[model samples]
Target: MADEINRAPAKVQSALLEAMQERQITIGDTTFKLEEPFLVMATQNPVEQEGTYPLPEAQLDRFLMHVLVDYPDADAEHSILRIVRHEQRAKQQSAPVAQSLVTQAQIFAARQEVLDLHMETVVENYIVELVMATRNPKAVDPELADWLEYGASPRGTIALDICARSHAYLQGKAFVTPDDVQAVAFDALRHRLVLSFEAEAAGVTTDDVIERLLSRVATV
Candidate 1:
């Protein structure tokens, strides 16, 4: 996992993502395959954007979710303080956190379960419509045409479907629904979209555009 991934140069970002996509590392003329259950979690400091290089759309789309984590609420902050003190105490006592955890095989099996979850035709259609809307927002609403520089690729459609299913699975559901799609749409598509200068000038974000798209695009 990388912190301040935005600090990495363009070539470094490219190499990293290439390794992720190929699931292999290359040294000289040799390539080595990555082990199963490979995952990369990265963090970007939004407030410290001054020196950071903005990740290109190609690199951004490599991530399955672009969850925006914000500061904890008052109660959560107090709980965090308690957790820190508890951690210190645990360290002093040489206590470990919980020992229980899922293995790679278990995680892979869960992924299989998500793949097996039933997705109805209309829900699939809804996902397609949402992606199509991004590509051709004017087809959905005229004003949206000014907001997008370019729509998401077909890859976005696949990402949306898989993420929606993953969402439903995580929620302990056996079937996928429009709500499942809605729950994961923002994180799935936020980094995929390329906003227009007009959108930026208007202080609009991809999240804002995605919200509008969700409201307008419906299965019914």
Candidate 2:
């Protein structure tokens, strides 16, 4: 896990870019391939925080999803406290830790299953339209034209398709639907967009633009 990644300098971020995009790393004289199902879990403070740097667009594009983590509710916080207490007690007693029930192979299989989930032609077009709207916002609505300085790249298209399929699969569905696309759209596309200065000055957020995109774009 890359904890507090925004604390890292530009050079380190560049190295991570190669690993994330090519699934390989280059050392002094040799390159190494990352193992299958390689995943990167990174955390960062908001850019407004002290000593934090904003991530470059290329590096940001490499990330599949950018989820905002809010404070947990009271019930969840209570559970977290209990978990910490249990861990402390276990450590004090020198008790053996429990093994994870999930296996690596199971995770690989689940990923494959998600990829194999059916998505119809119409649904595929819908995903494309959503991404396209980001590129040419004026056609969708005049206000969006002023709000966006830049839109999601082709990677966003692929991310949307796969993420929608995964969402459906997790819901025990055999096929993808428009609702699945909408469900994952905010997390998948929010970071990819570059909002205009005008939008920011007006207090327009990426989520607000995304909500507009979802409302204006037709399924068919």
- How does each model score on TM-score? 0.92, 0.96
| Model 2 C-alpha lDDT per residue in residues 1-220, reported as the tens digit of each score | 7899999998899889999999999998899999987978799898899999999999888899999998999999999999999989989999776899988899999999999999999999999999999999999999999999999999999999989999999999999999999999999999999999999999999999999999999998
lDDT of model 1, residue 213: 96
What's the TM for model 1? 0.92
Alpha-carbon lDDT, every model: 0.89, 0.95
User: How high a TM-score does candidate 2 get?
Assistant: 0.96
Candidate 1 weakest ten by summed lDDT:
45-54
Best by TM-score: 2
